[model samples]
Target chain A: MSDTSANRRQRVQSAETGMSVLKALARLGGDASLTAIAAEVDENAAKVHRYLLSLVQEGMVAQNAATQHYHLGPESVRIGLAALRQCDPVRMGEMALVRLRESLQVTCFIAVMGNRGPTVLRIEEPSLPVTVNMRAGSVLPWLWSASGQAFLAFSDDADIRVQAQAEFDAGNEAQRSMLAGPDPVARLCRQVKEQGCAIVIDTLLRGISAVAAPIFDARGRVVAVLTALGASNGFDARPGGKVCPQVMREAATISHAMGFGPG
Target chain B: MSDTSANRRQRVQSAETGMSVLKALARLGGDASLTAIAAEVDENAAKVHRYLLSLVQEGMVAQNAATQHYHLGPESVRIGLAALRQCDPVRMGEMALVRLRESLQVTCFIAVMGNRGPTVLRIEEPSLPVTVNMRAGSVLPWLWSASGQAFLAFSDDADIRVQAQAEFDAGNEAQRSMLAGPDPVARLCRQVKEQGCAIVIDTLLRGISAVAAPIFDARGRVVAVLTALGASNGFDARPGGKVCPQVMREAATISHAMGFGPG
Candidate 1:
């Protein structure tokens, strides 16, 4: 390679290392001493400090005057919020639902926790559409529908609590009996957590089966739910079934796209 | 310098250039082609593309497969969320309030738009307390208080509209005349926006005057309002007065800390 090419390649390598340092700072939970960041990125403290000075100058990282600990700066937050605004759940979910419908040959949909409840945002039906009552704007039942169950299973929000209680109080005897126990909600939630998804068969609607999984944001909050439903006669809503895992995988993909993952 | 030292310095320079490329992308609204980013940072497209590849590898930027336009990636969102989580408005407001109280020798406070109204979250008093009826948890009226008006002026939210209208309807005849016009709310909002801060003199309380300004988040949403108040005799609540500018400066400082600014 020419000397100029070599210099350019060296510069790119250095830039990548600097980005790794920034990523390490974020991975360290957004606040850490220079020493800690250097250790995290496996670089010497002096070298890390130099990179940090550049980051600070660019307003991507800030050093606290009191503690000298580096944290993400306004530029980082601005960039993130921009990314957040761009990564629309409906758009991403629509793309994922189409892929799921094509691959699994089932009717798939995405639902977001709207002010009212789990409101369906997007739906993709296979060549043979599943004749369920739900449409794009259908608000699924809190304790009955698979999508709502998945959200309830993962959330601890006070608003969700009120909505769930109201739904339970308004349910008829048969609906209440389906979740029969001293603490049926807790039991159902525990089961869903254990299975990594929520499954329901002929519960929310007659002859309808569904499997759903929660999509989490970077903050580990459930932002949306992905669900696949079909006729109970043909759909397998079992915990360890093929559909359950597929739904979970798609949900995980969306969550990953939203910057949620294991630390 | 030794060859090794020269190489290290060159690497650092390259890293800074790469970061500039990333920042330029963010400045361009978080999505752009390599050519656009290169132009934004005033670098050659080839050099910008190389830096983008490094950023893409680090997951701080991603190129859309269909369009090949680069945007902030998941890691950028993750880091920004960390920054957002870290930049607590209450804590930052508390610090700013203390400074305002110390510098101006006036009672200063910060309020967030809570469910009820503009709810005071933090308050700092000068050596002599203002002796107001309000406390930390006091909920200021939407149309009456400077803090509330600052928020109402900046926000186009339906919730704020409902709350402001309710406050207007519940006001007594004398209180209603305080904002007298065909569309008093619109007039007040327009004045506040024009002033870039809200000011009130003996409007909410008999002997009190206050100046408040909105603290915005990364998305330019008013997340909090910073207010300073004193006895009507001592306080200067005019738009171009010393107190109004101080309050606006402090609020802008906090907003910058929260990642809000002009592009």
Candidate 2:
């Protein structure tokens, strides 16, 4: 690359590193010390401290005076609120999730393809309010989750495969041979695309299972993945299963509401 | 200020200026151009342009490929999601807003004192879903809206008075003599505190009225302000009106949920 372009690239890379510190704090449950944040991002503590100071000054993060731990600031909240409003997929999918949860007696969540992974955007629980880890803004990995597999299989983006491959490559060495080559993932994708849904049993978390379906927009583009999660013992993963079809129906409803149709 | 302190202050001010560009885009509904952002922040175009480029690179802002208009990025959404999960006032207050809307058959909202103004955090509408302009992330001035007035009156923070005074001084000539002095605002605050609610009629917007109450934490600090709003014709703003008492009751419920009281 040319010198100027290389310089620009370095600037952008540094900027992304700064953003990663913020994301690290978020991933660590929204409040952490500089040491923790640096360890999460695997960056130097002194550098992360400078970045945190700048972010705090910019109001993207705030440190509690008493505890001296940093969390996302009010401005980040406002910016996120704006992002949530601007994204129609999450907003429209919420009503469908609520309806599904009310009728299905299961916990339903919407996960969109965020930069890192399939990030949960909205969630609804049954009357009992089942204890589930999924929530809005949580990013679940693609290697072993219903929402991840659904998006991986059904999304039109060819880049999805590249991302999945990167994540798989980053996975532990022992797990690489479990699913074999790209053939396995491709075969599963074909099956999911044919059945119009994806199901996983105790994939990511023990004693929990999920069924999810791809949600498309007007142009038939996969915009999000909607899932129903519950205890593994009673939860069904069959395409013909009760909770499975409901998630697909909700996905179709949300997709239609998002302007996806016969056109 | 000493030379070192002066330099530190300038650096922090510059960082804040960069953040202002992001806030400006959020204020203008989360998509604007470099010129628009600079104009909104009242900074030079070159400086704001640099800020936008940096912000976009940081993933705090994103520019449309076609329009080149800047919008909040996914990272900002993630941070904001973290903020929403962390802030109990907005989250816990949501249940009260929903209950109030359902039981009272009106549109209810929660507004917290944001950096700029009284920012709406959540809104719940009745079964019919009332057509109201207010939404999450909207900032309402303290000098006008019911939620704003509630915060001004019931909040224990002395800075609240300073903020109100600053806004009043910046107001146009007509509004200056309208509230007369701090005594009038003080008296209104006293009445609101005494009644545990605040009401406004045909003040901020035409044909609209509202009633609001403060949500306090365990320390008795005002955390949020809850308000019910509708058309002036059918909407009652009377102290003993149907919606007024219910709002106060709901506010009390939310305050309790927020961990208010010795019990």
lDDT of 2 by residue, B90-198 (tens): 7556667777877778888888889987899888878775466788899987767888889999876788777777877787775655576557668767877787888
The lowest-lDDT stretch of 10 consecutive residues in candidate 1 chain A is A1-10
lDDT of 2 by residue, A42-124 (tens): 98887777677767766678676557788776666666666656757776576777778877778888888899889997888
Q: What lDDT score belongs to each candidate, Candidate 1 first?
A: 0.84, 0.75
Q: Per-residue lDDT of B1-263 in model 1, one digit per residue for the tens?
A: 12365445534677778878887888887888888999999988877888887887777887766578898878888888888888878765666887899988999889998888899988888888879988899999998899999999999898887788888999999778888789888899999999999988888999999999999988788999999999999877777887989889989988987898853
lDDT of 2 at A199: 84
Candidate 2 DockQ score? 0.16
For this target, which candidate reaches the highest DockQ against the unseen true structure? 1
Worst 10 residues of 1 chain B by lDDT: B1-10
- Please give me the total number of clashing residue pairs in predicted model 2: 1
Please write out the lDDT profile of model 1 over residues A1-263, one tens digit for every residue: 12365545634788888889888988888899999999999999988888887787667887776678898888788888878877766655656888789988899999999878899988889888977788989998888999999999999887776777678879899888888778777788898899999988888889999999999987789999999999998887787776998899889988887788843
Q: Write down the RMSD of candidate 1 (Cα, Å).
A: 6.5
Score chain B of each candidate by TM-score: 0.86, 0.62
Interface RMSD of each: 4.7, 8.4
